[model samples]
Target: MIGTLRTVVLDAPDIKSLAAFYADVAGLDEHYADDEWITLNAADGTRLGFQRAPDHVPPRWPDPAFPQQLHLDLRVPDMAAAVEHAVKLGATRLPGGGETFTVLADPAGHPFCLCQSDGDSTTIADVAIDCASAGPLARFYSELLGLPVTWEGEGGAMISTEGRLPVIFQEIADHRAPRWPDPAHPQQLHLDVEVADVDAAEAAVLALGGVRLSGGGDNWRVYADPVGHPFCLVW
Candidate 1:
C-alpha cells in the first residue's frame, strides 16, 4: 500500500455552512476550523474536511457536462426522519434512488445518497466516486490504500477500508474528469492520503498508473489517480 487514507476533503464556496450541514445531518463534530479549511470527525472516526473554494462550481448530477465527480453515502436508521432532517437543513431532493437509498444535494450542490441503515445512528458509509470505468479506479485505490476490493459488479465496485466507511466507484459513461484549479471543470472533492515517505510513495504511485499534479508543499504532494481524480500524499 502506498499510504493510508487520511481525510476526504470537499471543495465548498462556503466552508462554514457546508461543514455545519454535515455536522447536523450526519452527527459529525467539528474537530478544527478556520477561514480556508474545516475538519469534522465522524462518529465512526472518519475525518471529513471542507476546503474553501471561493468560486466553486457545484456539480449538476446526472448531467455529463457538470458531472458529479464524487459523493458521500450516508446511512441512517430512520430513512424518513433522515430525509426530513436533510431537506430542512437546506438539502434539496434530487432525482434517482430506490427502496434502500435516496439522492439529495447539499447546500454546496454536491449529490449524496441517504441510505437506509440497520444501525441506530447516522454515519457516512462510503465515499462514492464517479469514473468512466469503475474497475480501473477501484483497482487503483485498492492498491494505493491497501484496501481490498470487497465487491465488484457491472457498473460499480467497492473497496473496504479499515473504518466502517469504504470508498465506492460507479461507472459514468460520460464522466467528465476534472481539471484541477479550473473552476469550470472543478474537482468537487479529493482524498488526503497519509504516507511515511513522500518520495518512496511518489515512486510507487507513479509506477501504479498515478500522475504527479502541479501544486504541493513539504508535508504534502498532489497526484492524480489513473482516472484523473486528485489526491494528496501527506506525511
Candidate 2:
C-alpha cells in the first residue's frame, strides 16, 4: 500500500469558524487546532481537517469552470429534520436534488449531500468525488490506499477504506480538472495520506500515474492523482 487515508482536508477562509460549523452540525469533536489548521473526528471514525486559505474560492457546483473536487455524503436519520438542523447550523440548501438526498452548501460553500438515513444519528456516510470516469479514479485510490473496490456500477464506483471511511466517485459528464497554483480553478477538497517512507511512497504513486506537483523536503510533498485531485504524501 502506498499510503493510508489519514485525513480529508478542506480549504477555508476561516479555519476555526468552518471547523466549528461542521463540528456543531455533525457532532464531531475537535482533535487538533491552530490558527492555520483544525482537525475534527466524527463518531463513525471519520477525520476531517480545515486549513487556512487566505484567498480561498468556493466551488460553483454544476459549473465546469469552478468545480467541487470532492464532497462529503452525510447520512441523517430524518431528512426534513436534518435539513432543518443543517440549515440552522449555517448550511444552505442548494437547488436541484432528488428526494433521497438533499444538497447543501456548507458555511465555506462546499457542496455536500445529506442522504436519507434511518440508521445513525448523523454519520458521515462517504466522501463522494466528481470525476470524468469512475473506474480509473476508483482504481487509483484503491491501489494507492490498498483499499478494495467494493462496489461498481455503470456511472459510479466505491472504494472501502476498511472501516474508517469509504469513497464514492460519481461520473460527471462535464467534469473539470483543477489547475493547482492557479486560484481560478482550485481543489476545494483534498486528502492527507500518511506513509512510512516518503521516497518509496512517492515513487509508487508516481508509477501509479500520480503527478508530482511540488518538491518534497523532509516530511511531506504534494501530488495530483491521474484525475487531477491533489493529495499529500505525509511521512
Candidate 3:
C-alpha cells in the first residue's frame, strides 16, 4: 500500500455536536475543530473525523432499504452503564433483539454499538462495513490500507495490523451502496488515507480495483473501492 489509513470519517448534519458526542463517549481529546470538520484523537491510538453534510440522510438500522453503510463498534467495561451514559450524552437506544451488544443512534442518526469488554474504559474495537460479501471487500481494503487479513470466515473477515484499529467486513444478505451527496442515500461513513503523492496513489488505487470519483486538485482525491465504499487519499 502506498498510503497509511489515517481516519474513519462520519457524515453529520452538525459537525460540532457529533464530534463532541464521540469524543465524550470514547474519552478522546479534541485534536482539531472547525465549522466544516472536527477531529478527535483517541488515547487507544485511533482517530475519528466528522464532516458537515447539510443534506445528510440518517440510516435506518435493521432496514436494508436505508442501510448503514458503515458502523462503529466500541468495547466498554459495562454494556448497560455505557448505554446509559451514551443516552445521557444524546444517544438514543435502539432495539437490539437480545444481542449481547447494545445498539444506539448518535445525534446525527448513525447507529453504533457498545460491546462488553473486560476493560475499565471504552475503546474503539472496529470500523465495520455492511457488504454483500466479506472476502473481496476485505481484501480490497486490506491491500489499500496495508493491513493484513487477520481473520476470515463465511460470514465475515477482519483486517488488522498490530497497534492499529481493525477494519471489519460483515456479510449482510441485503446490502446497498450509498448514493452519496444525495439525501435519498447518504454516505454514512468513509475512510481517509495519507499518501506521499496524489498522482502515484491514484494510480496505485486504480490498479488495485479502485475507481476515482472526485478530486480536490493536488492535495487529495476520492475513490470508491470494489464494494462501492468511498474513501479518500490525502497527502
Relative to the unseen true structure, what is the C-alpha lDDT of residue 15 in candidate 2, on a scale of 0 to 100? 90
lDDT of 2 at 183: 76
Residue 172, model 1: lDDT of 88
The residue pairs found clashing in candidate 2 are none
Q: Pick the candidate with the highest TM-score.
A: 1
* Per-residue accuracy of model 3 over 1-235 as CA lDDT, tens digit each: 7688899899988999899899889888999998998999988768899988888888878888888899999999988888899999999988772456989999998999999888898899999998999998888888888899999998999999888889999898878887655668777899989998888888888998988885464667888888788888988
Lowest lDDT 10-mer window, candidate 3? Answer: 213-222
Global Cα RMSD, each model: 1.0, 1.4, 1.4
lDDT of 2: 0.88
lDDT by residue for model 2 (158-201), tens? 99955768889999888888887677778899988999998899
Best by lDDT: 1
* lDDT of each candidate versus the true structure: 0.91, 0.88, 0.87
Quote each prediction's TM-score: 0.97, 0.95, 0.95
> Candidate 2 clash total?
0
lDDT for each residue of candidate 1 in 118-227, tens digit (9 for 90 to 100):
99899888898899899888999999999999999999999995654689999989788989878998889999999999999999999999999999987998898888
TM-score of 2: 0.95
